[model samples]
Target: MFKNRYLYIFLHIIMWLGYTALPVLNAIQRDTSKPQTNPYTNPYYWAYVSFSSILLFYLHSEYLFPKVYKQKPIRYFILLILVIAILLVGRYSARINFVGNDINQTLFYINSFIQYLYIFGISASYSFFTDYQKQQSTKRDNEHERLKSELSFLRSQISPHFMFNLLNSLVALNRKKSNLVEPVLLKMSDLLRYMLYEKDDKQISLDNEVKYLQNYIDLQKLRFGDYVDIDFNVKVPTFSKNIEPMLLIPFVENAFKHGVGMIEKPIIRVELQTIENQLLFIVTNKFSNDVQEIKDGASGIGLTNVKRRLELLYPEQHSLKVQQKDNFYTTELKLNLRQVA
Candidate 1:
């Protein structure tokens, strides 16, 4: 695309130069005494001269014509008188004389008139183009705002669904008189508070997000215990940037819910790191290969919601990949932090 612009400019410049020099070259090369086929000595010079004159006329029409129109016929006559004065000036100018004896003056009037005409035409065209561009930009901005609003709504729905499920689990454990249930509930409450309050903003500190994830993982460990081997490694940085709320939790929840909960000897691994203006998250889980036993063809609402949020919030600034083989399910999300900042 860039190459095309440069190529256009180069061709335009060459054409203009050729037009200006052609008349002079031809006049000097051929008989000056005999009548020339083309009277203008320099077509390129006339082109530029015409272009400039027309541009000026367009500006004058925009700014000056309004005042002139207030007086009706008097203003109209003045405009005609101005044209005659311009013609007389052209008839005497030596610059025009060099280009074509007396005919040079006539050519000057014709060229100047054409230039003014073009100036009006181009000015109208430019005004229309600018208005069109602004309208297009506004439409795009409206679409983006709508997408963000939808993402926020989805995130709001996901948080409640997660809380409802966790509470249900805690209720079951409580009825059984399980000793571990109380502490997990307390931790869940704290995490829920964070999500409900702190995450309402467009961004949250990375440190806070990681802390919540860790707490959530610990709660899961209390429930799953040794039946699941969960490995989580997130090296916290001294300073933190911000990220969208509840964006990564769905993947973690899905991992435990579908992968570990269904398999006898399940393993879930997660790794996260941030460097400069980039954040990377990787999660992999081992699941049973038995297709028939894989309950209801897991269409994860959380996963779908997170993917849509990522696309709306980040667009070209983020990359998300999901892979599922016979026994392993993997998801990697990379986001550009610079945009949020």
Candidate 2:
């Protein structure tokens, strides 16, 4: 506002003109027809009220407000009292010199000081209000930046976590000298491509994400080679809904990592379906007491990272339940999805 010089001057002129017109409006409202009893009939009365008000407001808003903001109340009060005293004298002289009859100095000074102080109060309130708005805007900006940073950090963690688990899968093939390494590497390339290209997106089509999951499952099937029974079911009415990328991988990965080794007739079940913009995913697997969740101190990151991402991205819009019962581990996720336009 201050940078626009013409607008600033125009607004101040309009405001002060309205201020000067107030006494005349008041006199007209009171039916002050006799010039002897009418203060508005005198041109000096306009100066007395309008000039003092504008000067006092400017002084308070510009100089006195800075003093108060800087915690210099003593100097502000002293300078304010001096300015009001001088304006009061000017008001008294205007009344005496113009009307010149039955002039009570005390009452006139008192009323004029009250009016000046009211303008000062108004200026102070304006300063505080503008300052409060700025503070709230700054606070909101800082909060947005913090959330963005946290989500970025969370996204950065996914690539390494995924690479680590995938390397273990490939290592198993190497140890066995299996011919499946070639297909697994090709599938891994596809997964890595999607992960690399789509990691920066806030959301992605549920169709593409589901395809990524299918590729991962296929790779896993190649690695295990019929040793583990994996049932993956997916049902969706449409493919236009959007989901956070990499949000659903952890549970299925967790099942494969902790459910397969050292167990007879190992089984893993994954169910994904969407019902009118709501997504439900369930992963259940058979596990033994000996096949604990901890493996190389990193089996926990998958679930833990997904949980934190769910909280940050979905907030109150999702439900996740993880439990183990009857030697079976299960994780259920219900997410509210965004439909495409």
Candidate 3:
């Protein structure tokens, strides 16, 4: 899982503050020595130790680990040892200058070596953890981009195929010299404009998407006229929400493609309802059992593409159910719009 960077920073700040203040708090509680004799009482010694620890931690985390450790592990270990030795020498010199010659030199050196090891270990662990997190984040971003590009290609395929079908409908109308042809052409123009311009957006207003769907239904109404029974109802209280562009059209297109021709009393039903952040969509169409079995690569490509898109884009945020009972094919989709993005 991903962690909030601000929260990580806040917790690290609290830890560092505690680490810096604990020694001073202990010295104050004991109150056993004059400022001139006690090393803990000397502000300069505290400043040097605190600043040196912080500087070494960042140096390893930001520079040494990234630039050296991954490429040259043995060299990095040698450099680490050198850094610890130098820090120990500086610490011993500070102790001699500030704490006087009465202190046990051997015991001080041992304690300082242990302290340096502790500091180095903490810095190394933290650096490795942060680098691992960065690598994971980069991998996720690259995968998202790949899925997005694939979805765009799938949508492009749908547009040309849909346009070909629409043009066929227009040709049929031209032969009959129907009065509805002009209106159908007008609606088709609007639909094409939306597909060309708005479809490229990552998302568009739900209201606009509904409008495009209505235009598509209207165009089909002109094509079939009174021969087919179609019911399209939309009950949306708000228009502020957004959805993936061209996401819903394929289902509706699939319904009209296979549901109407060579069937008695052809029927297609579509309903859309939105309550707060949840959206429910249903589409049901009648199909003739006598018709040839629809191949996956034939009229079912749109449905296949849509299923993959939903898995890539929404994942756990949406549910889709497709069922076939009797001579009717039904699809129901429930989407949690609030989970988008």
Candidate 4:
């Protein structure tokens, strides 16, 4: 960082030198018809240029740049006008000295004016750049904070949604005195164990995630037998891998809630496939216009939070698409799996 700073300052000095040299150096070098003059080759001219460059750079770095935040607009405006007027006077004095062939006077006045302008302009530009950078930095920070808050809200909603449905299943079974109650109870208990303990992590083994999803599907299948149909097809390698736990369940839940809730004979299709360093998930649900109005989650949140989570966790590595046409709702998600591995 320090090296970069030095390089930046060195470059700025070179830029000012180049700008100043353009008119003066060209006029001196191009006047071939004039007699040999020692003024062009004088050491005094070089010294003046060097001194002016250093002073301007120091003013910009030490005072103008740092003082921007402290100065009110009215005060700053007044200071700028004063500096401009001083620069004009200095330039006039330098021009007269040069006309009189007084090298010392010319250098003192002209170089001072040029240096003042260079520093003032450069400082203003530098301050503008700094303000731009600060604005971008603030925007990025706000986006990060928003994404974090959204993820927290989504996760909270997911926990309760899973529990609420499981409890309903248990309650229904208890009312009917069904023989499947005991096994379903055990499955629910196991699922609760995973949700409570394992899901605290940001990620879990792919095998474990698949197992939990299977159990969840089985539990739901027990509730709606012939009236509902579920087809889950997953093609994955038998390798040790990890995934964001419960990430796919919300899509599945969405299907069950809308697809099978009001339809006479609803079909829910889910497919999961992983190849190399990517995971693909596609869920399609059949719903009718007769279905009940979509209900927001407990805290008046919806799938927007899920979308936000995908952005934060996956960023450029994932793609999500929602398509609604006629009576079908389909969601497609493709995630790059290499990072988790």
Maximum-TM-score candidate = 3
Mind sharing the TM-score for model 1?
0.63
> Model 2 compared with the native: what TM-score?
0.82
Q: What is the C-alpha lDDT of each candidate?
A: 0.71, 0.86, 0.84, 0.72
Scored by lDDT, the top model is 2
Please rank every candidate by TM-score, starting with the best: 3, 2, 4, 1
Cα error, candidate 1, residue 333 (Å): 2.2
Among all windows of 10 consecutive residues in model 2, the one with the lowest summed lDDT is 290-299
| Per-residue C-alpha lDDT of model 1 across residues 1-341, encoded as one tens digit per residue | 99988996797578656745665667767866663444544554455454454434444445334445445758655774575456436533634554544455566667656655555565556555645776799999998788768976887778777876587667765765499987887898888898778877468777778888888889888877787899999864643677887788888988877776557689999889887878999999988876344344334777888888887778898998999986889999998774335
Identify the superior model by TM-score, candidate 1 or candidate 3. 3
Residue-by-residue lDDT tens digits, candidate 2, 1-341: 56788896898799878878878778777875664477776777766778788888888887777656369878878888888899988888787788675767778778888888889888889778767887899999999799888888888889999999999899998787578889899999999999999867469999989999999999998988789998899999899999999999988898998889899889999999999989999999999997545457765888888898888889999998889999899999999999876
Q: Kindly report which residue pairs in candidate 4 clash with one another.
A: none
Clashes by residue pair, model 2? none
| Candidate 3, 1-341: lDDT as tens digits | 14677887889789888987787778876775543455766777777777777777888888789889999989988988887778878877877776667778789889878877788799889998989999999999998789878987887787877787789789987776588889999999999999888987478889988999999999888888889999999999887788888788889988988898789999999999998888899999999989875454456777788888888778898999999999999999998774334
Candidate 4 residue-wise lDDT at 24: 60
For candidate 2, the lDDT comes to 0.86
Off by over 4 Å in 2: 1-23, 32-37, 40-63, 66-68, 86-102, 292-294
Angstrom error of the Cα, residue 43, model 2: value is 6.8
- lDDT preference between candidates 1 and 4, better one: 4
Indicate whether candidate 2 or candidate 4 has the larger lDDT: 2
User: In model 3, what lDDT does residue 222 have?
Assistant: 83
Model 4 per-residue lDDT tens digits across residues 1-341? 99999998899778767865564676567775662353433344444544554555555546655574366666656766665565556444444444434557656566656657766677668777776788899999999888778677777777787787678767876776587788888888888898888886377877788888888888878777667889889898753666777888878877876787558779999898888878888999998886567554542233555676777788898999989887789999998774444
